[model samples]
Target: MADINIQRKKSSPSPWLLILLVLLGLAAVGYYVFRADSDQPVTTAPAVPSPEPAPDSTTGAETAPRPTNDPAVADMATEEPGGSPDELAAFAASDASAPNYGRRGLEMLMASLRPLADRDDLRDATVSEKRDDLTSATSRLQEQGTSLRPGYVAAANLIKAMQQKAYPALEADAGELVNRANALSGRTNTAQEQQQVRDFLSRAAEIVRALNQPAQ
Candidate 1:
């Protein structure tokens, strides 16, 4: 009986098995890194805030937007000199003893006649239409009554002559009107009143000059 001691040889792993194990380990590590990245929160840029409006220098408040190019807005921004014709006429028609009564009355006269004298359609207007316009303007003037300065009477008379077609005396009437207006010059108490009277006279002179032209 021979005692045969058979020793089992220790087998090493195959190269393919070693490669598979290495690949599995690498795959696990890659999956954990991918999951860690996926779990992380996303970063983004911060939002920018709007700029504040500039404060007004005088009021220390935010200024309003600038006005557009609308004509009505322009008209509102810059008021008419003195006031509108309707406003002047209203002032003239008020109590006779008001402080600005005489000045406003004369201003109303100037304002009323300015459109008539400058009317482009005047030449084309019928005789009756011309008389009607003159009559209306004269009536507006007369509404001021004693509030109007003394000189307006002659001017009104001249306009009346035009309405009546009394052309011969118009020249004399116009001359008298000019003389009266000149006589009243610089007689007003205030510089403003004086300017108003002067403006009225200038406008009256323009009307007279237009009337003096040969009938077209």
Candidate 2:
């Protein structure tokens, strides 16, 4: 057993060589880790888009309102000397025939009889005169807005006519007065005549005021 024995040499450490080996091992580890990381691209967050505002209205164009008519309102406006001239003109325009023609025609006929009344001849007085006298009396009963009150609309219309200074309208209004007078056909007495005279006179006063003002 002693004849064939053999031994290998054991190597001794070099400081510089040992250091170099350690550095090389660290470098290899770093390179392997970096190489793996480079294979995958860096993850990034997605971007968000902004939204736009919408337009208004389903259909195009904005429309304005139309004007309306009110008779009551129109009447209220006629409180002045010639308060509703335009309204009166409109009223006048509405009628093709004069509404007061009957009254005026009767007045004309009675005016002829004034001379007979002046002579105090009650017996010889014509039928037209009697009608006229009765009309005069009823009108007197209704003066200063007292009788046969048709409310604001009629009053405003009357005022408007006076304001306009339209001669034909004035004639029509006079006819209306005569008709109001003729409302009483058969009554015979001083009281009826006197009362009607007062009303007609009140109307006369309003007309006088309207006449005095300058036309608008």
Candidates' TM-scores?
0.38, 0.23
Task: Evaluate model 2: give its TM-score.
Answer: 0.23
List the pairs of residues colliding in candidate 1: none
How displaced is residue 40 in candidate 2, in Å? 1.2
Clashing pairs in 2: 84-160, 135-181, 135-182, 137-196, 140-195, 140-196, 140-199
lDDT of each: 0.51, 0.40
Judged by lDDT, which candidate is best? Answer: 1
> What does candidate 1's lDDT look like per residue over 30-105, in tens digits?
9999999999999999999988766656556656757688744543343225443445544544554445555555
Model 2, span 54-162: residue lDDT tens: 5445344535433436633432332123223233323323322343322322232223223222332222334334434433433433234333322212332333334
Q: Which 10 successive residues of model 2 have the least lDDT summed?
A: 74-83
